[model samples]
Structure formats: structure tokens, C-alpha cells
Target: MNEQLQSITGVILAGGQSRRMGRNKATLTVQQQSLLEIMLNKLRSVFQHVVLSGSQAAAYHTGLPVIDDFFPGCGPLAGIHAALKLCAGRGVFVIGCDMPLVPPELIRYICNCSNFDLVVPRVGDYLEPLCAFYHRSCLPFIEQALNQGRYKITSFFPRVRARYLTAEEISRFAPPDRAFFNINTPADWDRFCALYPDLKA
Candidate 1:
């Protein structure tokens, strides 16, 4: 673990309704580990303080602190807002529960570059906001967006200082597609299983 990452908190956003998968994606199993477990282990390796957003603290038995959405039904932005509040003064690395294969190396890179209010990855033209870094200072802007009923995570991007990792930079850690791959449906899970049979779903 990098010493610099000690001041950072890791947050796993597990509040999604999973309408597409028709099940709680966080509990979905890959190999013998649940998606939540996989992300928890990965984040615990680098961050000293790791928490779950949108899960009941007692639900997992892992002892990690769990925080529910402060603004429920507001999408991931609310989760991000809650995580920022939990982080307090420390920076936070936020990743969705369905993004099971997010590379630690990539996380390290993002944290290393998190000098601004936000540090996000750009794969081609799209931004992977879920697997990104946020500073506590972003709280105000995020709160404003939520209060205005703006749910898109990028709704407040223009109002903050943000750093974006280019495709060339991401390739050094993992393939672009695999790095940000998130399972939202049965077919997506099948695709992941086919790609990594040893870690079959």
C-alpha cells in the first residue's frame, strides 16, 4: 500500500436497485466471492478505511462501516454524496459494486493523480465516473446538484477541477474494456464468465 493512500477512504457504492439483473448485483458470486467481497478485498489492500454505501452495516458481517444514501432515490450521485460525507476531510476512491475487476494499479494511479477535486478515467470519449476519485471539497457542488434534482454524476463536473486519465495511460494497467467492465445484466455476467472462465459466475 502506498503511504499517500493512507489518508484516502475507499467507498463501494452498492445501492443500485439492479433492475436489469433482477437481483442484488452486489451479492452476485464470481468464483467463490461475492461482487461486494471482491471489491472490499481489493479496496482494503490499499485504503486503511473502507466502507460500503447503501448497505446495512450488519448485512455483510465484514465489520466495515456501512452508510445508506442520505438522499435516497437520487441515483449514484446520492451515494457519492453520502460517501463524501463519510470521508470527511480525506479523499475518497469510489467504485460501483458491479465493477468487480477494477485494477488496483488503476486505483493507485487515480489516487496518485487526485490533486484536484475529481480524478476520473476517460476511455475514448466516455468517462468512467464510478471508478473514480473524489475530494471532500466536492461536497458542496454535489449537494447542490442533488438539491436541484440533477442525478447524473457528471452534472457538477464543469464546476469543479477534474483530472482525466487518458486511454494510453489506462492501457498500462488493464485493457480499457476490462478495466471499466460492470455487470448490469445476465448477458453481461455471461460475457464476464466467458472472458475469465476460472472466475466464472
Candidate 2:
């Protein structure tokens, strides 16, 4: 583990309902590795502690701790809220399980920017909140948001100190399109397979 990441706990936001994909995306495989496994490999290389945010621990079977949302059914905000609670004031490096393309070098760079409460990547108007680092200082705002039904992942961003990695900065590690490409539907899987045709079978 990188010493700079000792205070960070890696979190995989795997609680998505997957209705659009028509199956649990986490179970989908690439080159014989489950999406969850692929996501774990990306995070485990940078942080000592890694966890999944889901309904049941056994559902993932990854052996890492799975935290169920305290504000059940809310959304990714709820998962981040619950994971932040367990960080004990440490920051959380969160990524969605559907986002199998994010690289660890980007994760390490973001985690190194610990001066802000959030370290997110932005492409003009879009923010990659799911593939960002969230500080525990965001908990109260997140709590208020969830209570008020503000379930968007970026709902609490306004209230926290945030550093957005620009498209130019993010491009150094990987192409912006592939770095953030997430598999949400069968069509999305087809697109990913097109890029890495060897992984399709």
C-alpha cells in the first residue's frame, strides 16, 4: 500500500439496482474476471482497506466488508454516506462497480490530493463523483441531503471543499472516454467488448 493512502479506505459502490442492465452488473465477467474482482484489483493496489457498499455481504462474496446503506433505497449518496461513517474521519476513495475502466494511477493521484474534502474528475460540466475521493467532513451535508431526498451523487458537493481534476489533467493517465466508461446496459457491454474484443466471449 502506498503510505500516502494509509488514511484512505477504498469503497466500491456496488449497491446499484441494475434494472437497466437486466442483470447484476457486478457478476458480469471480462477475461474470466467478475466486474467486482476487476474493480477490486484497481483499488486494492492503492489502499489497504477496501469495501463494498451493498445490501448483503454474501451477495458480493469478495470477503471484503460490505456496508448496507443506513438510508436505504436513497442511492449512491447513501452508499457514500454509510462508507464515510466507517472511515472514522479518514477519506474514502469511491468508485462504482460498473466503472471497470478506471485506473489505479488515477486513483493514486486523486488520493494524493488530500487537501480538499473531495477530489473529483470533471469534463467541462460533467463530474465523476462516483470515481472520486470523499472526505468524512462531507457526512453532515450528505445526511441533510439524504433526509431531504437529494439523492444525486453530487448533491453535497456545494457544501464541501472540492478539487476537480480537469480533463487535461485526467488525460495523462488514460483516455477520458475509457477512464470513465461504465457498463450500465447490454449495449454498453457490447461497446466495451468492441474496444477489447478479446474480453467479449
Candidate 3:
């Protein structure tokens, strides 16, 4: 079945501790809306089933269901694991909650790539795994890696039919750097504000 037969679930990775930012990055705001709200709006624009990959469902009242990590303390890979199970028999399109600048167009492009078991973007030498797609076919690999305590998100990439979007390809929607920009610290937040000075709140 293709992405259509089962539909891809849009997952927002919101379980981060945000140690560097020194606050809940998901609650940080732009134009009066929280980063979490911004990411949710982006996902809702592209997918029918949108959810948050976080255990603190009580903290967020976005109206969308939040799926807790099945492999607690396993990092982002745990979120992906829970998402893969929730997709029924398809794949998932996921993104980090701190990435408020991510465009829905880029997300759509990733979701369109149904031919690969893993679809991610590479900007320069770094892979944007949070803003990628993972198929159910990747379940076993993810499971094995997590079970073995190899929680790195890319640990199982080599074992799957992986596809990485080039920086040039990503430029069609937004600058590769801008599209995947995530706020991890106060300095990064300042940079984002400087990058978009007009953005209030």
C-alpha cells in the first residue's frame, strides 16, 4: 500500500527537555502563538491525522492526541517508535516542535516521497532526521536498535531504503538552513528573532 491507502500520520516531537533553551521551547512564541501551536498548524495543513509525540498530554491542550513514548528515555527514536506503531501499517511525517520556521510545503514534499523506507533531508553534511518520513517497514530496524540500546535516530538508516533530499531540492520551498532551523538555546532564539525581526511575540 502507498501513503494514501493508510495515510501518513503527522507527528510533532514535543518531548524534549529543552535544557539549553532553559525553558520549554515548545511554549516559546512568535506572533503571539506558541512554537507548538505553529508546528501543529503546519502539520494540520498537510495531514489528516496529526498528533504530538510527548508524554505530558496534560500540559498541551491543542485538541490533538499526544502519543507517549513507548521506549521512554530512548530520545527521539522513541518518539519515532511510538509514531510507527500509531500509523497502523503506513509511515509517519515527523518534525521537531522547536522548528517553528519549517514550511508546510517542505513537509508536503517529504510526505510525497512514498517510495523510500526512510525519507530525510540533508543540509550540507547534517541529516534532518526530525523533519523526515519513516515507513512501517522500518519498524523492525528501529525496534532492534532501541532494544539493543542504540538510541541514535540514524542507527538503522543503513538497513532501510533511505532517501535524503538534497539542500538544492529543499531550496525550492525555503532556504535549507532556514527551513530546518531549530531553537535549542537562548542564543539561537535571538538569532531567530534577528532573522525575522518583524515577527512579534
Model 1 per-residue lDDT tens digits across residues 83-102: 89867546789999888777
Rank candidates, TM-score, best first. Answer: 2, 1, 3
- The residue-level lDDT of candidate 1 at 166 comes to 96
Q: After superposition, how far is residue 146 of candidate 1 from its true place, in Å?
A: 0.4
- Model 3's alpha-carbon lDDT is 0.85
Clashes of 2: 0
C-alpha local distance difference test of each model: 0.86, 0.86, 0.85
The TM-score of candidate 3 is: 0.94
Each model's total of backbone clashes? 0, 0, 0
lDDT of 3 by residue, 6-115 (tens): 47888999988988999998998877888888888888878888888978644888788889888987899999999998765478988999888788888888878867
TM-score of 2: 0.95
lDDT of 1: 0.86
**Of the candidates numbered 2 and 3, which has the greater lDDT value?**
2
Task: Indicate which candidate wins on lDDT.
Answer: 2
Minimal lDDT window, size 10, model 3: 1-10
